[model samples]
Target: MSGSEIVGDIAEGALLARAVEPAAGEAPDGHTQETACLNCGTTLCGSHCHSCGQAAHVHKTLAAFFHDLLHGVFHFEGKIWRTLPLLVWRPGLLTREYIDGRRASYVSPIALFLFVVFLTFALFNLAVGPIHVEPSAVIAAKSGGVQAEADAARELATTEARLARARRGAADRRSGKRTGVRS
Candidate 1:
């Protein structure tokens, strides 16, 4: 496929993302000591701001940052665990419940659809890799004859050396070494 088509496909997948919500007053462990929200200057009566709807706690630590990042990227804030089984066994009920506005308790239908689509693509990508091919004749046309053969031999040797070094590194890690063994 053309580069534009490939990019368009990726963009289609990218559009429906970022479903996971943060741990708010609605969710558990949303306690905040501060009296005012960091955003909008709203008086904090609860764990989240009423005016801007930002979390009042506003975690600054590295762990919380990663937690939020994971949640944001994968929608792993406990909704997928609840949504998927129901989507499989009782799809009609799940659809009805989502339409009836019981959406907060499960992943949204669109988000779940996008997740499953990308997951299928990921499994295929890992198993099969890139689908296109550049012909050997094209390579020979670019470099030609004896020089091409020498270049190919040199490239093969370099690749084999890298593979051997990687294997040695893997063996070192498996043997509980602090560092990889140098070639």
Candidate 2:
């Protein structure tokens, strides 16, 4: 048989199997099933709906949730492998291909962005511990308290005086006034 005919046969067989098998979300006790799509009321054929593409199985188990998380991070149908090189080295080409609708071969930009951001945050948190600020009391305890306060006050006054002089200089320049000092 030709390739197209073979594919058609497989599809027909799948549909027949779906018809014969118990629908999803059924308990198999001869009662009506709630397997109908919540989004569009179509019978789901597999894990996802053929009508609306929403997931047919909404897993409530913790194991299933972790499985989905790992699958999303690591599986992703090898699209990340294809997208990363173009994203890092040839971003313009990536943008062009996505804009031109040649997208089946690579991850979508939004998906890639989200994945990258998640990966970045995960790695950052793993590598760097949370920042802890030393309170002023702790800092004062470390440095001699009275001396540290006096030094900080002196530095602040010096900084304020410098800033005031700079502001006066700028105002003088803007008003086209010159100090009486010779060049």
* lDDT (Cα, tens digit) per residue for candidate 1, span 1-183: 999999998786545432333433343454436677664566878877787665677554456756654554576468788888998899898888755434545765656666778899999999999787569777877677778799999999999999998887888888888573443
lDDT of each: 0.69, 0.69
lDDT of 2 at 77: 82
Error of 2 at 48 (Å): 16
- Which candidate has the top score in TM-score? 2
Off by over 4 Å in 1: 1-74, 133-183
- Poorly placed runs, candidate 2 (over 4 Å): 1-75, 132-180
- Weakest 10 consecutive residues, lDDT, candidate 2? 24-33
lDDT (Cα) of model 2 = 0.69
